[model samples]
Target: MKMSQTQAPFARLLDAPVTLGDERGRIRILYEQGNVVLKRSSSVQGVFRGLHRQAAPSLQEKIIRVLSGRIYDFVTDPDDSDGVIWYREITPETDWVHINARYAHGFYALTDVEFEYFCDGRYDEAAEESYNVADTLRDALNLGAIQLSAKDSAGIPMSRPVRRAGDN
Candidate 1:
């Protein structure tokens, strides 16, 4: 069933469908040492769903803006592509690491700032909702704080920052 704009973000399902698909991608940021890898199984749902809790008009734009500056490279690039530059989904070497960011808490990649959201092969559905979530993320990162109306804050929680990458 199609969800309404007013509806909350995606679900925090146990079995989420996530993958890089056939197309190539990239990990646009360099947090700690070198290349960082974030598994999706959880990040997608958490990030995207976390956004739906609010009532913002420019949610996706916010997410893109914040991520744009931080993301340095893509998996489809040339130099790293030869070694390990593709952003495609691979089998996780281990269980996800729960990065305790101030805001929302979820699994994060040790070296990278990316993660996967297992959505039961419903990426098309998730994609449609990503705009709002991405926008919310953008606001969270750029504005350093998201101020939503009381009504918009209905199902939302009072978390500071969602996930922190390689922050010990």
Candidate 2:
């Protein structure tokens, strides 16, 4: 996973999920300016919530190794609802495989619902599992749904599907 330009330096810092500790893995590259640490806690929060603070541990590393100026395509699902999720792939060596093997495998295989943020506000930012978690990951990050170009990375990965309470 190396970038295209080695000597020119990246246009901007980009972050990628890296295997580290147990619960709090690692996010390398610190994309956002000034944020140095990422934190995580199992609390209910809505997706796309406006100006909400996230709890995931902020991962930081001095710009060193450059991999895939482009985020690899190993985390996408080619099937399911609208194919809307964006997931990161994990394997046995990676910490996430044990965090929840079922979900991790599904995400890697595109058989599970991936997490996604929609509406750009509290209405659908980080909502919990309404559909299959495996399926959700795939839907929320699909190229057509989020429409993120192949050249960039998304702010968040699709860990599960989202929905409102009054749905039929």
Candidate 3:
């Protein structure tokens, strides 16, 4: 499978496997790794989720696949000097995204959507951190009037210092 690099140095776009079988049915393997957590989420159009990551010891590498509908996905490394935010429009049409643990991930639902992700680490609520999507990305994209979860709405601005694991 060919992997396409996104603008973010730590993320890539992978082509999903083609399905096999006839009109009777079809089957495709989305992933084949063990010791990872699988998660599913559904969102309505106009919803914006994340710019989130698990810090330090709890860092997670995620592979996201859109099961239905469409989304504008983004990834960025907060520590990068260049401050590049890579984005792509994703659909169910055989595109999967791989985000490294060091990058923050987020997406805007362009339509009612369902997606599944495989994470290499267990979630640690206390280690979770997020950047305010609007403050960081709104000017870069044409996202308008997006709805955010209470936690997401309260995310720290990109200009603020992110707390690392040992900060006192």
User: lDDT: which candidate is best?
Assistant: 3
How many backbone clashes does every candidate have?
Answer: 28, 50, 0
lDDT of each residue in 74-152, candidate 1, tens digit only: 1111112233211112223424222211112211121223444211111122322211223334444442333332333
TM-score of 3: 0.71
Q: Look at candidate 2 and tell me the lDDT of residue 96.
A: 25
The TM-score measured for candidate 2 stands at: 0.18
How close to the true structure is residue 154 of candidate 1, measured as C-alpha lDDT?
A: 50
Q: For each candidate in the order shown, give its overall lDDT on alpha carbons.
A: 0.25, 0.25, 0.73
- Residue-level error in angstroms, candidate 3, position 152: 0.8
Q: Which of the predicted structures, 1 or 3, would earn the higher lDDT when compared with the native? A: 3
Best by TM-score: 3
Judge candidate 2 at residue 94 and give its lDDT. Answer: 29
TM-score of candidate 1 on Cα atoms, chains taken together: 0.20
Error of 2 at 90 (Å): 11
Ranking by lDDT: 3, 1, 2
Stretches of candidate 1 off by over 4 Å are 1-111, 125-127, 131-168
lDDT of 2 by residue, 1-168 (tens): 222334557553334533232221222322223333222211111111111122223211111111212121122232343543333432222222111211111112221112211111121224322222333433545522222212122233444343322211
